[model samples]
Target: MKFRMAKKSDLKEIVRLLADDELGSKREKYEDPLPEAYYNAFSAIENQGGNQILLVIKDEIIIGCLQLTIIPGLARLGIKRAQIEGVRVDQNYRGQKIGEALFREAITIAKSEGCGLVQLTTDKERKDVFRFYEKLGFTSTHEGMKLILN
Candidate 1:
């Protein structure tokens, strides 16, 4: 598998991956336009120097995608932190460690970009997934809540 920065052209495949429930359920109204928004958001992020979107390809097919966003702040450590979002691996490719590989690559990218820490949020009900992230070196450090616009 090869990993590279995502381009606008990869939106369709990325959306398909994100649409898969194995990945996670998407936001209601935004679900239909997610592909376009993902591309636009990624473009905006890269342009702003706070985001990096990557795609994992195998056999010329996009198997996974992730967005890493850097948060600049004046905190205890002077290091910028990264937030991982829109992470999804194709259903057919699930058990192959592609997700882990993608995450590892994202972390490498974050570190190279000078981010002090990396973070991501998964649904609390996903117990197995929480374990997986912990195994990959992420800690449960904070609580998160969201009120999606209806």
Candidate 2:
């Protein structure tokens, strides 16, 4: 598998991987022509200095993806942290350790960026994933909250 920063052309495949999940299908709309909002959002991240969408490819097809963002904060003594989000592995490729590989790559990038820590959030209902994350050395030590504004 090859890990690389995603190109605009990979957006649709990445969305396919994301929406293949039970929970993601509720939030992501993966269609023949993906909504302009996805493209617009991709462009925004592509232009940011500390943000990137990473793709895992095998045999010239995208099999997994995740977005990594380096956030510099004053709360942690001005340390930089890596936030991993939107992780997904293609349904056909699950159970093959592709997700694990993606996480490993993200951590490697975080270290190169001088990040002090790496963190990610998953829905509590995703019971199957909690163990996988824990196996990867993650701990459930903090409560995560979110607000929706329209």
Candidate 3:
């Protein structure tokens, strides 16, 4: 497997992975010629200096993806942090260590970017994901809440 920053051409496969799960199926509109909004959002993220969508590929097939953003904060002595989101591993490729490789590469990138911490939030209903994260040394140190405006 190899890691690389996602390109516009890889969006379809990335969306496929994102939409494979029950929770994602409700939110992602993965279709042939995906909605324009996805392209627009991807463009916005691509233009951001500290944000990137990373992808994992094996034998030329995209199988996993995640978004990483470096944030500058003043709370911890102006420490910079890496915020990870949209983590998804292809359903057919689970239990093959892709998830672990993804995180390992992300953390390495975060360290190279001078980030003091790396964090991400997953839905409470994803119990298996919680355990998966714990195995990677992540702890539930804070409570995260969200309010939907849409």
Name the top lDDT candidate.
Answer: 3
Q: Write the per-residue lDDT of candidate 3 for residues 31-146, one digit (tens) a residue.
A: 98899989999999999999999999999999999999999999889989999999999998999999999999999999999999999999998988998899998999999999
lDDT of 2 by residue, 12-125 (tens): 898898899889999999998999999999999989999999999999999999999999999778989999999999889999999999999999999999999999999988
Give one digit per residue, the lDDT tens place, for model 1 in 1-150.
999988777766776777776335454223555645566665786697767678999999999998888888788567788899878888899889999999999999889888889989887666777877898999998999989885
Q: How do all models score by TM-score? A: 0.85, 0.97, 0.98
Ranked by TM-score, the better of candidates 1 and 2 is 2
Sort by lDDT, best first: what order? 3, 2, 1
Better of 1 and 2 by lDDT: 2
lDDT for 117 (candidate 2): 92
How much does each candidate deviate from the true structure in C-alpha RMSD? 2.7, 0.8, 0.6
> In lDDT terms, how accurate is model 2?
0.93
lDDT of each: 0.80, 0.93, 0.94
